[model samples]
Target: MGASQTQLRETLDRLGLTVPLADALWVLDPAQPAPSMKTLAGQLHCDPSSATFLVTRLELQGLTERVPDPADRRSKTVELTDKGALVRGELIEAMVAQSPLAALGPEDQAAALQLLRRALAQAERP
Candidate 1:
């Protein structure tokens, strides 16, 4: 897992992204309501201040933007820009290319995915 993370970081660095920012962008759904800062913090398992800093960096890079939350006029939500989505796609491709699963056959990959999903689901349970 550490080696995989290191490879992902190297790929992201080549594209001018940090792991946190890439993670934040990857979680966003273009067709869904953008998550509020607090929600993002919860998703990232970080404090609100850290989420704010990450968002600020993404905003400066023109990869993300903050808009007024319709549900709460005083609050804001973060969404990916067109550029961010493109970059995120590239990141996905790069990560997949570097993945150990890349060497597996399609059937093996499917099996692996199923097992991994099962493990994740079990981990999520109490």
Candidate 2:
């Protein structure tokens, strides 16, 4: 797991992303309501301050923006700009290209994805 994580970190770094910021960006959905800072923190499994720091870096890069939540003006949500979405798409493509699974046939890749998703879903359960 550590080796895989290291490889992913290197891949993301080469694409101009830190792991935390990349993780944060990956969670954003431009078509949906933006997630609050607290929700982002929860998704990242990090503290609010850490999430804020990551989001701030992305904001500085012009990839993300903070907007006031409509339901609660006191709270803010992080959103990806068009630029951010482009970067995210590039990141996804890069990751897929670098993936060991890329060597597999299409059917094998589908099977692998299904198995991986099932395992991930099970891991998420209490």
| Candidate number with greatest lDDT | 1
Model 1 error, position 126 (Å): 1.5
What would the per-residue lDDT of candidate 1 be over residues 1-126, giving only the tens digit for each residue? Answer: 667678788788888888888788777767777999999999999999999999999989888999999999899999899988888789889878988899999999999999999999999999
Which regions of candidate 2 fall more than 4 Å away from where they truly are?
1-11
The 10-residue segment with the lowest total lDDT in model 1: 24-33
lDDT of each: 0.88, 0.86
- Candidate 1 global TM-score: 0.91
Q: List the residue pairs that clash in candidate 2.
A: none
Q: TM per model? A: 0.91, 0.86
Residues 1-126, candidate 2: write the lDDT tens digits.
455457688667766787777788878867778999999999899999999999999999999999999999999989999899998888777667767888899999999999999999999999
Using TM-score, give the best candidate's number: 1
Question: What is the clash count for each candidate, in the order shown?
Answer: 0, 0
What is the model-wide C-alpha lDDT for candidate 1? 0.88
